[model samples]
Structure formats: structure tokens, C-alpha cells
Target: MKTSKGVKRRRVEKDGDAVVATKLRKEFGGLVAVSGLDLSIPKGTLYGMIGPNGSGKTTAIKMIVGRLRQTSGGARVLGEDSPLSARLADIGYMPQEMAIYTDLTVSENLQLFGSLYSMEREAYIKREEALLSMVDLSERRDSLVSQLSGGMKHRASLACAMIHDPEVLFLDEPTVGVDPELRVGFWQNFADLKARGKTIIITTHYMDEASRCDIVGMMRQGKLIAEGRPEELMERTSTSNLEDAFLEYSWRDSV
Candidate 1:
């Protein structure tokens, strides 16, 4: 009961879209998690989706990644429909919860993901080394995930997600629990991945991180209320920061 003005939208179509959702909807008994959502993400761009907790960010990503079934409508990734198993090898996903094997050493977990993609031993090792270094976990490569601190486990999970060098990455709050310094490094890593032509979509509550993305979508009550370049959004809302812009949009949407 808050939103009022409808935000301008980008034209959404399948062509050139790395991920596309059309009239996408999801439900859980009486709760409507997502409602008629339409999203378009082009290839090789860093897109950030920001919203309050339970705003349906994770649900949207899971539907896009084919991890969850939608109650209605559809989504396509890399030109294929949902459940993109054929393209799974080309996609990377770092969920909100740690997905790495806790019983395995950092190195072993990386290797397992690499092996899943049928990566050659030499290639796997080479990539593992670089990822470990990128995540600043080289010193902890032999450390068991269960023994590592929470932040370290988060980093290891990121490394595992990127070990195969997927063309597209869906990172859900990748910087959670990370220290400021390490968070900077993670953004740098994301920048490097973007420069390498990877399509990266990240969901975060951090307004600072939203400014770093090439484009951002603001979601509220399971609906996208606004989508645009961060600066454009700020200018439109007469806001000085993304947080303000988000509030303005959410306010507009609520009425």
C-alpha cells in the first residue's frame, strides 16, 4: 500500500539477453513469493538486484538458475528455458548460504567443482591456484572448510563457484560477513570477472555495492519497482545515495 509512480523500464526480449524472465510468478500455498516479474539481463554486464530481506531476490535467482520451479510464467537463460541443465556447465552460482563442502579442504572443494565440469587436471589446478589467490585463501587452501572462520568459508564458497570459470555468475550477497578490506577485494574480483565478459548478477542489501554495478534493479514486495543505472536512479529520485533512491522507489511503489 505504498507505491505510486511506476518507474521507467528497459525493453525486455530474449535476443542478447543472458537471462530473461517473462510474467514470472511463484507461490507457496497462500504466500505469493513473486508476482508477474519481468527481468532482462544482457550478457557480460554486472547487474545488481537490491531489496529488503524476503523481497523475492533469492526466489527470482533460483527460478532463473532452474533450481526452483515457478508456479506460472517462465524464465530463460542463455536462450534456453528454465532448468538450464545443458548450460549449467557455463553458469556459476554462489548462494546466500555456504555451499562448499565443510568436511573438505578448500583445495579439495575447488577440485570437486572443477571435476564436475570435466576440467582437465592441469587446467583445474591452474584455475584453482588463481581463484585461491583471488579470494585471498592461498594460505588456507589445505584448511578444512569446517575449521575455517565464517568469512573464510564464504570466500571458499566463492572460489568453488568460480573454479570452472563459468560464463555467467549469480552471486547472492557475496560480501556478507566480509570485512571492509576483503569486501573491496571481492568487488575487484567481480570487476575482473566482468572485464572477462562474464555476465554477473548479484543480490545485495548493501547500497554502496549497488553503485558499483553497471545497472541495478530495486525490488519490493516480490516485485521490481525500478531498474536503471545507479546515477540515473538517484537523479530521478532526487536522492544522494542508492539507499535513498531505493526508499523513494519503494515509497512510490507502495502507494
Candidate 2:
């Protein structure tokens, strides 16, 4: 839990219990998307994935969630293979696109997804109320999704993902179209979830926001260029911010 003279440090456990990947790889025809990559996320930790477009960040996430089959690799989430029957109920996934039903009312949409996991109506009702209020959308409980603004739609999507109360949440670009004010609120919500022992893994292009992560994995061309706390990466790269540090790391990696 120590850092260099100019670096800030955050405490993260390096215990045996974690979400892990070893030699993870994916390919599409002649193209190799993710190649021999390894990642480990500790339980109850906040982890970030950062990279330029086409750097295989999305591919990596897809594999972790079992949406894409790996070409040659392996992954273990919460001590079991991802997509295994036992892990299905413990993982909540929020994709990059808004997955809400445009025609359904907020409550109806929640009920639809909630029921998919066999969540009882009574349990779903209780969670629905708490989640709706948490995201400041209680008044819109009966509004059709198409009536909400872009930010509100994102909020609704987040609520739907959490309705079943999964222990691990995978958010791919959760703040894409959110405004600054709402973005701040979103991070605050993430912090609250962390305090409650929920593990969050998110992918983002925003450098400033990436600093909020307990640990970050900077990726390039399907390979991990660096992995560490934000401040540790900055100090190691002799830079003041994540973007600059990423550039420095990429340069050194190429050399």
C-alpha cells in the first residue's frame, strides 16, 4: 500500500480469491482480437479497462462475460468458469448499448428482465422500488423508455442490470452519453456499491474517470501494456495524468 514520492495510492487486496484469466485469446477469421492476455480482479474490488478503439478491450470483455468463445484461453470468475450455471445468478452485465425495451414502461421493462432470472414478483417489486429511487427515476416508473432522455435511458439500463442483485457487475462504457453531473452521481453510486462489497469491472475511454478505479489495465493491440493503480502508472511513466501515462507506456511498449 505504498507509492513513489509523487504518487497517490489506494488499498486493494492481493488475495487468493479473485476473478482471473490466464492466456485468454480470441480471434475472428484472420484477425486476432485478444492475444495471450491475463487479468485478475480481486473480490470486492473496482477494476477498470482502458484502451483505444479496436485495441481488443471490447473483445476481452465479451470473452469474460462468456458472450464470445475464446480461441485459446481460460477464465475463472468468483472461483468458477464464467457462464457456468452456478455463476449465472452472480453476475450482472450492462452492455455498451442501451438494452431497454423502447415500447415498455420502466416498471414493465424491469419486470421483464427480472423475471428472466426467475426472480419472484414480490422480490422484484421490492428491488425495483429501491433501485428506481436510487437512480432518481422514481417519478418515471410508469413512463415508456422511448420518452426518457439519453441520460435517463442509461440510468434505467443500470437499474435493470441491478434488479436481480448480482454480486459482480460488468459495465461496458456505462457513461458514454451521460452528462457531467450525472457522471459524478454514477461514480458515487459505484463507490456505494463497492462499500457494500460488490465487485465492479468497467471499460471506459475517459482518462479522468479511469482514475477513480482501484486498479486499471491499459491495453494496446490486444495486449496489456500496464496494470496498476492510476498514480503508480503515472509515476512509472513520468506523466501527470492517465492519458499521458498511457502514451508513455505505449511508446515504451513499442520500443
Candidate 3:
């Protein structure tokens, strides 16, 4: 698949360089949403970012996706500069809010998003059908998004985000309103993506879900307080779960 700019988009970049963020900072007036934060995500791994409200989770993602300008510092996606040109096809973003049109049916929304990349008609159908199946929304393809439940809408939104089969996926609180069963399914889907060598960066306040990540970055007051494998973080902080580890890290940071 290729973006409208004629950049060929692959399912996974062969020997793709992991994401790198160096001193990434974003400020708004007197408030610094992201403060000299640095991060790295390996290809084919699931990375989780967790923090309390206003800890810069969403702000960081917005900066990465080019929705907001950084006050200072820099970042790179797929080895290119932050907000790489014509790199939209290399990224699939699922925002916290459902970005799909409420009046459009699931299939219609998928088709519309597919057209955004100028995907070929037959190719679009294949990709759309595959995505709908992966999201378990095939049965509801003709249903209006407004009539679907919160979980269903979220699933639809996810499918639309990947309409172009991006190599890197940025999911901001993907499973927020999903039920436990659905959440588990979502994790399974993420694992599947990992198997295909897709780099995934997920942000959430959910501790339990953070455990599913290969590495977790705990953000505090617009800074990355700690980052490591889930078990490594727990052991280093002498805590049993990610939530407690985050609190322990925060207390130490304050000291």
C-alpha cells in the first residue's frame, strides 16, 4: 500500500529502526505537557505508557503524530524526523475518542478511510474485509456507528485507523471502555500485530493492561519517571504490580 504522496507503505519495514525520541518536550503557556522526555520502542514489541491524568500521555502522542508542535527536543518515527513527511501510511493511530463518523455505517467508514490513501478499489476491499474480521465487526458491517455500543464503536475506529495497514501503530487508551472479555481479545489482537513485526505504542492509565507490554514507561508530571520490562520494573521497585511500581517510582522521583 502507498500513501497519497506515493510513499509505499509496508506491513513492516525490513530491519526497521525502532522509534527514538530525544529530549522530546512540549509546552503550552506556563504548563509543560511534556518535559525533555526520551523514549525508544523496539520493532515488533508492545510498549506501554502509563501515567495519571495530565501526566502528558496524550500530549506525547499528539506530538508524535504531528498534531502538536514540540516546544523543544526532537523525535523520530521509523528512523525519520518527528512527524516524518508522507509517513502517515507508516502509522496507524487510534485516539482515545472514537474518530469515526457517527452517521456512517461501519463499511462506509472503512471505505472512506481507505480512499484517503488512494488505495486501489479491489485492494481496498480486501484490506477492509480483513480488518473488519480482525476487529470482529464483520457481522456489524452495515450497522450505523451511532447505533453501535461503545465497545463496538471503538473497535470500528480501530479498524479504520489501520485501513492502510501501517507498520507502526499508536493507540491512545485503546481499551478504555471495553469490557474484560473484549479487553482480553484486544490484547490478543495486539499480540498478533507484534507477531507480524508491527511496532506498537500504547498509552493508558490501566495498570493491569500495562503488564501485557514488553516494556512500560511510567510518566510523572510530564517526565518519564521509569521505563523497563514489566517484571524488571516491578522487581526494581519492590512492588507486585505496575500501579504500585509507578507510585514507588514517583515517590523516589520526588525525593
Candidate 4:
């Protein structure tokens, strides 16, 4: 691991991976939300999880991020047991729901999150400025989150998540209700993050967005039905696009 200006960089294991899960399972009473799911994400890469509404993408992310415990199996994030508080500073998570202070201004929300990580005033300000620009919310810095549009709120939430500059980011449907232009910007930022050596794990239902990921995992009924680069999966299924490839995999899984 390397350190810069008091920030700890990711520890590169011999395997050069940032996240690893084996047989990860989650159950809610009789309902298996996630079952026997496996994942291996490399450093400095964007990995996407694509599945329908009930496919357990959120459940799996919660387990991996330590917000929710798994019923069986385990995972290692940043080379530590999943969800270790000691490693919290190294990870950032953006849930499907907006997780921001509704009454606070965008800058205040970013400041609060930065304070949570004990960032210094100078560092927080610098990061806040950069993040606001990245999310295209620089002009709305002082606008109360409640007063912003849904798309603006979503962007603010993303800025809050990235304020700490975590090495690993877990984003669940980050572009849910955004317009096409903003969605394009979001993917562009994701690529920039990956270039900066950040490992991003994103869950999205959009086939077009999934195609931008370095690798993608398709899930169904709490199980991962297929995994590959979007083009590779398409080729394997003899399909022309990811949507068709995903449908083919879902059909195969059903049988």
C-alpha cells in the first residue's frame, strides 16, 4: 500500500484484485435473496452487475460492503474480511436510494460526509470543489438538496460518495432517473475514476451502460447466470447486443 497526503492507497495483493467473493449467499427467512454468487474484481477496473428487479444485485452489494451480513460463504474487500470498519475509509458506497441530507446544501452534504471520514478542513474543501465539478453540480453547491431536481440530487449523492476518494466504489443503479446526457457524463466519470486506479462495482439494469464496463455479471433469481465482457457474452450467445445476450442467458438459466 502507498500513502499520499495522509490517504492510504489500495493494497495490491499478489492476485492484483480488489474484491473477491466465494459462494456468497443471503437469505431472508425462506427467501434466498442471493445464493452461491461469486465475484472477482480487479483493481482499476469497472465491473457492472446487471439483473432484473429481483435478481439480488443490491443484496450482494450490501453483503460485500458490510452493510448486510451474508447467510453463507464470505468475501474479501481490499484484502480484508468484507465490511471491516477499519477499512471503511478505503471504500465508498452509493445505494439505490438517495442517501443524502435532504435539507442541507450540496456543499454541506459533502462536508458532512468528509467530516465522517475525519478529513481536514483544507482537504475537504479541495475534494468538495473537485467533486462538485465532476458531478456537474458546481453551481448548485449552495442549493439545499431538497430544492434540487431529482437528477441534481442524484449527482450530489454521487459527489458525497466520492468526497473521500475511496479506492473502491460500490454504486447500485447510480443512473436510475437521470437523463441521457447526464448518464453519459456519469459513465465518463466512472472511466476517469478507473484510470485513477479506482475499482468500481456498479449495478445497473441498462444493457447499454453494462456494455461500458470492463466485465459484467448477469444475475437471475439470486444466482449469477453469466459473466463476461459485454462483447464476449454477446459473441458467446451469438447475439448482436447485450440485451439479447442477457435474454438468452436468462432463458438458459430458466431451463
Candidate 5:
């Protein structure tokens, strides 16, 4: 394949680093949603981006997944330039908003996404069944998504995103609206995904969840203020938790 720059491209393999972004930036009419951000995520690692609302976590993920184009700089996913057609199939994205069909049955929703990837009937069926079990929605498979509760809908949305078994997963506030018990289940699922050699990038506001990540990028005011393992961030700040570590970084950035 050839890029617009006339450079030949290589097929992105499923191993090694999964994402690389350099000076990535995004802007609206008069607002800059992301500014001079750089990111790198390795294969099989679970990385988290944590910040308050409107801090650009969603915007960054959108650009990486090709939903929104960056205003400047560049990013490469799975070794190919991001937003490239060849790379789309290897990426799975679940936005903060519900991205499933409300009128479709839980099973139908999963089937719909599986079909989008042109998955074979047998393969789709196997994946759909496993995902339904993982999300603990096997009993709700025939139920219309509209009839499901908020947390059920969230789980269903996640099932849809994973139906194709994409190599890279981008989830934004995936645990929001979920009960504490279910949140633990969700994290366990995340850990299982990582164990299976999938690279996962998640955005969350939950400080406790940040500790579960292999690395955490703390965002504030459209910029990444700190990037390190959760424990490293805490130790550097002399704080005992991610929340206080983030506050320490915010205070340093302010002054």
C-alpha cells in the first residue's frame, strides 16, 4: 500500500507495540480538545487514561480509532498509519455513549458487529456465545437491548465491541453506570483480555481502576500531565493513592 506521501506501507502485524502517537492534536472552532500529546502502548498491555470530564481522553481515543481526524501530527496503530483502512479491522472501539442498537436483541447486536467484520457464520456464532457468557448476558441474549438495564446495556455494548476479537481495544469510561460488583467483573475481564495477548486502552475517571492499569496517563486541561505506572506516579508524588498523585501533578502543572 502507498500513503499520500508516496511512501510504501507495510502490513501491520499483530504483535509488538500496538499504538504510537506523536504530537497528536485536535481542535474545534475555538477550542483545543487535545494539544501536543504523545502516546505509546505496547502489545498485551492494559493502559489507562484517567482524567475528569472534558479533559480530552475521549477525543484522543476518537482520533486514534479514526472516528475523528487529528488536526496535526500523526499516529500509527499496529504498525500502519492510523485511520487507515487496513488497520480498522484490527481495532475495536466502545465510546462513552452507548453505541449499540436499542431495538436489536442482545444476540442480534453482537451478530451485527460480527457481520460488519465479515466474520464467518460458525466463527461469529462461537464468538457471540463466548462473549455473552463473559458479559454474563447469556440469559438476556434474546432480550431487546432497550429492555435491558443501564448496566446490562453497557455490558452488551462491550460484547459488541469484542465480537470480532480485535487486536487493539479502546474503551472509554467502560465501567460508568456499572455496579461495584460488576465493575470488578469488568476489570477481571480486562485482565483476561490482556492475558490473551490483546492490547487495551481504556479511559476512566475512577482512581481505583487506574491502579489496575500497566501504565496510566494522567490528563488535565487537554494535555498529558504525567505518564507512568500507577505506583511510580504515587511514589514520585509521595502520595498513597492515584487520586492524590494526580492532584500532585495538577498542582505542579499549575505553578
Candidate 6:
């Protein structure tokens, strides 16, 4: 029943959760990037984390994905410790920044990721083709990443993240720079993945898109201000939209 920075703490347990955290905090020097985040995401859920920039969304993901060590607390993903030495192959992460190789063609990048996963040649080719089509890069497969536009690069990065059929996905601002039309397709893709039983966590700024998530968590100043089904959050605040609901939560947290 203890609290840190006004954020509640709970026992860290997976308990059928695809991702679970308790008192998850990250500090660089005296600044706490994540004050103390308690999170629980059930398996096969499409969870969205919404917040303004630097609200610790990316930092929290980095910690959960095992890319960065946390200052305190604990997290478990897919029943394993989050900071474990080896990342489970069943996890996929799409970071906010471009992570693909700039000098390689889109097809080549896919091949590289496939090889990393030790995929068979035939399976790799099949998955690569499907991913290319999904990201709308089938026509631009030969284009070098360096030559692709920002949005195109983003699409390529997403395709690469899903290359291995990971059961858990962490997408950080995945729709940034994406066209409105393409963004709709991306949401459909996410829905399809969820239907197939994947657990997804995404950080986004678009309140409209957040409203579409199965569960939405609003974050501010490194803490979760509110969380629930999008409709429920709006209903709790008596707000008509996610934006207004989030504003109400943020104001309450600040007071």
C-alpha cells in the first residue's frame, strides 16, 4: 500500500498478463523519467498508452522491452523478467525513431531480420512478401531506406518488427508521419493481429485513434493519470471524447 511520487505500488505478478509491472521507475541522475508506473496488460489485449511527449511512454517501453535497465521496481513479460539477459523472440518492438539500416533496400532489411530469427529461406520469403504488401512497400521493395520518405521508412520499420510473428508488440508512436489513409490500414492490421491473439501495447498522441484501442491508459508526468476502456474513461469524466477525458484526468492529477 505504499506510494512513490503519488503513484500506487502493487505486487509484480504476471497472473495471465502478457505484460505486468509494479513500481516501475527509471531515473537518470536526479530526474525520474518514470516516477512509478504500475501496469497490467492481459494476454491478447490491445492496450494503448496515450500521453504528451516525454511523459515517460517511450522510457517505460524501453524498460519493458529490456533495452534499458530500470532504476527500481520490476516488470515481467511473457512470464519472464523484463531485464533478463536475453529478449524473448516472441516480443516485437517498434521504436519511435527509425531503426532500420539506411544503406539497405527494404527487401534486404527484411531478409536481415529474417536471418536474425533463423527463419528458413522459404518461410522468410513468404513472410517478407506478406509484410511488404501489408506495409504497402511491395512496389518499393528495392528502394534503399535512405531514399525512402519518412513515412515509408516508418512502414518498413513496422514490417520488420512483425517479421518474426511476435506474440507481444510494443509500438511507440507507430503512426507518426503516416498518411491518414495508411493509418487506417495500420489500425486494421493491429486489429487483425489482436484477433489472432497477439498482445499489443502502443503509445500514441492521436486521441481519435486511442479511442479505438480495447483499453486506453492516459499518462502524465511519469504516472498513469487514468486507465480503462476508452468509452469508460470518457464516461467517468462525463466527456464526449478521449481528448477531453484525458484533459480532465490530467487536471485532476496536477491538482
Name the candidate that leads on TM-score. Answer: 1
- Give per-model TM-scores: 0.94, 0.90, 0.90, 0.93, 0.92, 0.93
User: Looking at model 2, how many pairs of residues clash?
Assistant: 0
Any idea what lDDT model 6 has? 0.91
Clash pairs detected, candidate 2: none
Residue 94 of model 2, lDDT score:
85
Q: Each candidate's root-mean-square deviation in Å?
A: 6.3, 5.9, 6.8, 5.8, 4.8, 5.1
Better of 3 and 5 by lDDT: 5
lDDT of 4 by residue, 6-124 (tens): 34333334257888989999999999999999888888989999999999999999999999999999988877898677888999989888889999999889988999999999988
Model 5: colliding residue pairs: none
Alpha-carbon runs more than 4 Å astray in model 4:
1-14
Poorly placed runs, candidate 5 (over 4 Å): 1-15
Clash pairs detected, candidate 1: 1-254, 2-254, 2-255, 3-252, 3-253, 3-254, 3-255, 4-252
Candidate 1's C-alpha runs over 4 A off are: 1-13
lDDT of each: 0.91, 0.87, 0.88, 0.90, 0.90, 0.91
Indicate whether candidate 1 or candidate 4 has the larger lDDT.
1
Can you write out model 6's per-residue Cα lDDT over 1-255, one digit (the tens) per residue? 556743432333345689988899999899889989999998889999999998999999999998999999989898789874455788888999969999999999989888887889998888999989989999999999999999999999999999998899999999999999999999999999999999999999999999889999999989898999999999999999999999999999989
lDDT of 5 by residue, 143-236 (tens): 9999999999999999888889999999988888889988898899999999999999999999999999999999998899999999999999
Per-residue lDDT of 1-255 in model 1, one digit per residue for the tens?
Answer: 554344323333346788889999999899999998998888888999999999999999999899999999999888889988799998999999978899999999988888889999999889988988888999999999999998899999988888889989999988898888989988998999899889999999999999999999999988999999999999999999999999999999989
lDDT of 3 by residue, 1-255 (tens): 435533333424422556777899998999989999988777887999999989999999888887788998887888778777878778988888879999999999999888887789999999988888877899999999999999899989988888887889999888877788878888998999899999899998999999999999999999999999999999998899999999999999999
Question: How does candidate 5 score on lDDT?
Answer: 0.90
The true-versus-predicted C-alpha distance at residue 140 of model 4, in Å, is: 1.3
Q: After superposition, how far is residue 182 of candidate 5 from its true place, in Å?
A: 1.5
